[model samples]
Target: MGIFRFSDMPLKKKITLIAVVSSSVSLLMACLVFILSESLTFPRVMRQNLSNLAQIIGDNSTAALSFNDSRTAQGLLDTLKANPHILSACLYDLKGQVFARYARPDAPQYWPAVVWEEKSEFSGGSVRIFQPVLSGGDRVGTLYLESDTREMQLRMMDYTLVTVVVGVLAFLISLLVASRLQQRVTGPLQQVVDRMKDIAKGEGDLTKRLEVTGKDEIGEVAEAFNTFVGKLQGVEDMKLDLISVVSHQLKTPVAEINGFIENMMMGLTGELNPKQKTYLDEMRAIGRENYRLITDLLSASKIDRGVVTVDLKPVSTKEVVGLAIRDYEVPLARKGLSLELEGVWEGGMLYADRDKLVEALRNLINNAIKCTDKGSITVRALTEGDMGVIEVADTGIGMDAETMGRLFTKNRVLGKEAHRSGAGLGLYITKNFMKQQNGDITVTSEKGRGTCFKLAVPRFKPGEGGRL
Candidate 1:
């Protein structure tokens, strides 16, 4: 078993522990103060009381001392029996000689001959007090009192008991209050976290809100989250609506242009000259690029609206790769760029929307073509684990750290030239399409080296999609 340290403790447990420790420390300090005050003040108070009693005794015994009567002096000192704290008492003459002494009846008479001291003090858990006896307003004798401190011990014990009770009560009360306080602070934050997770997991509902319990910091956090999500929802909605309208409008023109170019290439109206045919082919390429862009934009709009219609079917990885090569071969050949085919996709059956996956593959290829200028591009498809992986690698001008970091961010393209010439939505749309179809895309690149984009989708099993 691993040892549990305070750093590894969970939040609520940490909260509870802090409260308990604080209460314990406060109680411990109070206990120390009480003990210290008693240690000093208790002895002083006992000494003062003993000194007063001894003075009264000496005053009453003044005549006895003057008449040289031991019996009367002893009787005056014996009155100390009334105080349980007074262990023993002694009467002395003006010459400082012991005249009489008294002790508790049951207590051993351990009285020793004493000399006069100028101070009242505590020793051996007891206090000694001394007073002067007088006759005819002249110093006649001195009387001394010894206190046992048993009564003081009893009183201190009672004080200690009360302090312990209060400390325990304080600790228990703090735990309850602290637990409640911790709940109040963490509750709304937890709700915000759960709600954000729900949206990320595809619920995507921005209307849900955290209840505002107060106008404190926690409530402010909830309010900030709601406002931020509201803004994000607005932006996303506007983006999709604009894309849908623009793409739909552009699709018609691209279709018409492609139709006219195909007709000219097919010689539907009349035979064309060689130079005219070549220019028509170039126009066809341009038309195809436009058509593909419009299609991607429309698909992205559908995807953003969460209204994408996916038709997952068994499709061979080789066939998909072939389609991608066919799409890019003309452009690559024009640029004198070589396209290499690598490792066969043996367990080739993959479940995906054939058109959508093809579009994603094409974007990766096109993106590579944009970044890479001279070197060959490599296309590889292979089965790894439970997924089929398609890799499009380019040996061209690689990307910098900043470009790579924001590569798939919405409306952020890799290169400034590409941003000016093209909409910066290809990689972002490609990633979204892959995610909606339960796939993933990853990119690895190094500056001045090359870039590789990988698309991993689940391999199809027999009858995986049933009918649809």
Candidate 2:
């Protein structure tokens, strides 16, 4: 298994991460303060020990110098050496030279200083004490004493150990608290995620709301998600209702026209003359328009219900375009317009539904012929990138931005002129059918210039490749 990245982590992990990082920072700050306090206290305790030793050495030095006896001074120094705290002792003359020195024999060569301005070196824990000798206010020698600080060192060590133990206990307690906090934060988020997954799988019930407890950001998120789901459900219901009403309204007119056309064609009515036959032909044409409208309504209804299915196959784009042109040739000639086919290929194939592709192409052509006064409509196909592009360009009265925006919307009439001739479901049906086939349609137009509709489909085998 691969290691998870931070971005891929769930809400629970993110909450846990926040808790851990915050606790770690707090613990570090506490440790820093403890170390600083210990460092400050250690130096103060050592200085206090030095001051006490200095006082004791000064009293002994005063008695030795007053009696003017070297034996007494030496005896006092020997007694000081026997003490566990004392490390070394020295006596200096009036000229600051070491006249006499008595140190512990087992002590290190580098003994602690007493009167020098700089500190001295000693083994283990050490303190330095200085004493000046005076007799009748006359210049005399100085006494130096060195002492060990093992007791103070042991005290500091004990304090440090206690601090470490307390810190560890605090960290463990914080871990428990963090876990509980993470649970509280992630619980609602998990519910929201599960509900979203249900909605994506088509279970769009808006009443499935999360139980909001606290007024925190997580609760707010849950409330917002509930609102969003509710709005989505309402919109879906509205679309379904619209499709139902539009279908009923369109089907009635289409069924009536179909019945009328059937009756006339079967001669169920009276016989017709040449003029009457022409009128009947026009009525048949209107019936065909109504049939196209009904078909478009059905297609739009299916698309809205999300029930449209595509049958993908490796079909030749050239063959479909040729068939579309063949279907519209007679209509184009009758409407005083010309149809031009360009870039015909023997094996320009695409992966799409051949029947749907032909239907989409015919819609675009019919739309062009309806809008154009007297101009040529061109259908061209070529390969660009990894897709086959079919373009239908017409030198017709092109649409403005307002019309173009509603061109692919269901039942949206572009203008009164186009509506008087036919309904405006051609482009809408074309767009939906293209989408069902894993393709897309795009358009470009200007008011006085022209309009071009381009269909893009994934290309099939170009040279010597296998079937899709």
Candidate 3:
């Protein structure tokens, strides 16, 4: 019932169906055009030949008719019938009476009555001639003739048979050509489908590629598909490598925390004074920080695995930015940095997952606070173009061009003095989160000047803002 219903059928059957349908329609049209052209032109040709023959007989009989010599007139009529194509000859008086008639019995009987009047039916056809034929102002008896057109009918039949035969041959040839064309096209497509099936079933063989034999559109599609599969396989390999490295990094910190705690429990480090207990507490805090780092790493990995789904809704961008700044207030103060919020009173709603947006803003704020010392961190929100823009600018020790270039790259930590304490996952996670929300983040930094990170969230329309 649908156009694509036959898509899943076997390739051979599809090819056959296309070939048969196309050939049948082509043959039908060809036959119609051939028959119509012949029907129109054949009659006009027969009529022209009959007119020419009548002119000749009329010229020859003019003298005999004027003199009233029946023998002379009859001789002209006999001569006219000698030609096989001239089926009938007739002479009429001025009173519209048939004075003489010559015809073949085997031909159609309508010829004799057809030639006596200005408009008359002739041997299965029609003819017309003027009575009292005039030549150089002379009067002659009315001359008329009829043609059977049986030979013309026979010729037309022969032509029709030839056209039909040619149409059938052409249809057969087209069917064969179409079948070959379909094979060439669908063969490569089927190969790609089979390879895709194998890949879906966890086959990792990257050697399989669709063969490219031509420069057509289909061949280009095959090449593009092959390139995509190659890149996907490469990503899979990199993912495996990342998991292995992250696991090892996590295990080392966990092992150190466990060993340090065990040593304290066993009193192997010596008896602890009050001051020493404080140092131990600091060590425990460090262990907790390590644990938190591991948790964040796991969260980032889950994001990469597409395990996190966002619930998008309209939320005030100002409120979200203010909340992120508030969460990092104490840390910013401790680092001798001021956290400032501007444009908070402006009402601009963004369509996004509120929780995800908050998380993304928090990461950026944390990074800004950590990297800036003795300078202010400003979070600004406003409408820009079709988007709600949130910018976190820090007057900290900014990074160089090289560091800024690799800032959002996975596992890349900008080795500036301000970034010594961070794991480099903050911006990566923030970038990914923005992408999930159909938003984007950009960074501009110059060494010792300042760093400004911009986040753009699409503005929400009234009644169009809801959970995605």
Candidate 4:
């Protein structure tokens, strides 16, 4: 129903198709030229051959015609039997009357009764010629000859058969050679495409490269690709170093600033007015947020450098949830959002890193509070099979499918409206933290409804080598 466009073909097929089509067209043209040349040249050669035979007979028949020896003229005419293409022969007197005649058994009986002129022509698939008899440089009579074009026709057929056979063999050879040679071009291109796919799928192994085997265009392309990826790798390293340095340099000052604000509120300086106290409080909050951002950056840098470690041990999920909630109690009241803890801990102890579990809980609760405006937040902890599951559900502005897909991806900020002050690294770090402890985190959300985050940690059992 529709044309198959050339662009839609794969690289290898495109190359092979080009080679095969080029060879086929060239072969076709060559065959056509050969056939056409033979078609024209073969007829001329046949006419020349017949004329030579007619000339010899006319020269020898002069004596017979001048002396009125019809018998000798008949002998000259009968000599035409040597050539199978000569269908009939005749001798005409000076008055243009037929003097002698000869015809092959299969030739037609009808012929011109008299010679018309000294000329040769082709008509009705046959050649006819009228030549003048000459003796002593004087024209005496005429010699008429007629020939079938069967010999030339047969030669043309033979040429056609040979051309067809040769064309087919050449086509096969060209196809075979092209199919093998095209790999030299498409092979490198295919390798580049595969590496690109691997990078696009987040494998991100920039160290991998195409093997350069020549100094041609393909090799140049491979060199360019390798250089580009190397530059990207360098940029990534520089970014990580910058983040690590800036965060480390800022974390201490922010913590000290928050300490000084706390001391001022406790009247380490002169007692402050209400306005001064409110300003100090605001300063403390801002300092604490700055400190949190620095901590997240440091943790992310450590994760990137593969230096983050988890101290796995038996821990109570209930204690971890209680600790995480206490940190958010002030923010929850400020926002007038309800906080409900539905965790009844009758389950087995979790085999996880206690600090990492608490940090993960705090990140989830913080995100829930940030997204939610008026609705309540619920924390549910329970045991299923050999795992302890914590569910943090919030009546907040949830995400669409497009945002949800990259929710835990590093360096991807979801939406500016949803996370106005977030660095987009909290969930990424938390997910990695859970993974380090042999646990996992999952999420579910609807665009307009709400979001639910689930964190699963393995249950601890005695005599199990302290491993999940």
Candidate 2 stretches with Cα past 4 Å from truth are: 1-270, 345-347, 411-413, 417-423, 462-468
True-structure Cα RMSD, model 1? 8.7
Which residue ranges in model 3 land beyond 4 Å of their true spot?
Answer: 1-31, 93-99, 107-117, 120-132, 211-217, 239-468
Q: Which candidate model has the greater TM-score, 1 or 2? A: 1
**Candidate 4 structure lDDT:** 0.86
Candidate 4: tens digits of C-alpha lDDT, residues 1-468: 489989998877788888888888988898899889888897788778877987888888888888999998898788778888888888888888888999988989766866556788899989988888788988788877899998888888898899889888888887788879888888888888888888888766876777887899888988998999899878877888899999999998888889999999999999899999999988988888889999999999999877998898888877788778876778999999998878545545889999889999999999999999988999998877878899999999999988988988887867877976767899999999989988899999997689999999998887878644
TM, every model = 0.60, 0.49, 0.45, 0.77
RMSD of each: 8.7, 11.7, 15.1, 5.2
Worst 10 residues of 4 by lDDT: 340-349
Residue pairs with backbone atoms closer than 3 Å in model 1 (clashes): none
The digit string of per-residue lDDT tens for model 1 on 217-302 reads 87888888888888878987897899899999999989998999999999996999999999999899889878877887787688
After TM-score superposition, the amount by which residue 248's alpha carbon in candidate 3 deviates from its true location, in angstroms, is: 8.2
In model 2, the worst 10-residue window by lDDT is: 111-120
Candidate 3 backbone collisions, by pair: none
lDDT of 2 by residue, 1-468 (tens): 589788998767777777777887787788778777877787667766665665565466665655556667677677766577666777665566665567777776553334643243343467665667655575466767677777667767786787778777877777778778888878877777788888786644655667777789878888788788778867876887686688788888878877887788778887867787788788888878877776776777777676788887888877888788876767788878887778866438798888898989888888788778778998988888877889999988898998888778766766776665656767777888888777899999987667999998888864655333
- Error in Å for residue 400 of model 4: 1.9
Candidates ranked by TM-score, best first? 4, 1, 2, 3
lDDT scores for all predictions?
Answer: 0.80, 0.75, 0.73, 0.86
Lowest lDDT block of 10, candidate 1: 413-422
Model 4: pairs clashing at backbone N, Cα or C within 3 Å: none
**TM-score of structure candidate 2:** 0.49
Clash counts per candidate, in order, are 0, 0, 0, 0
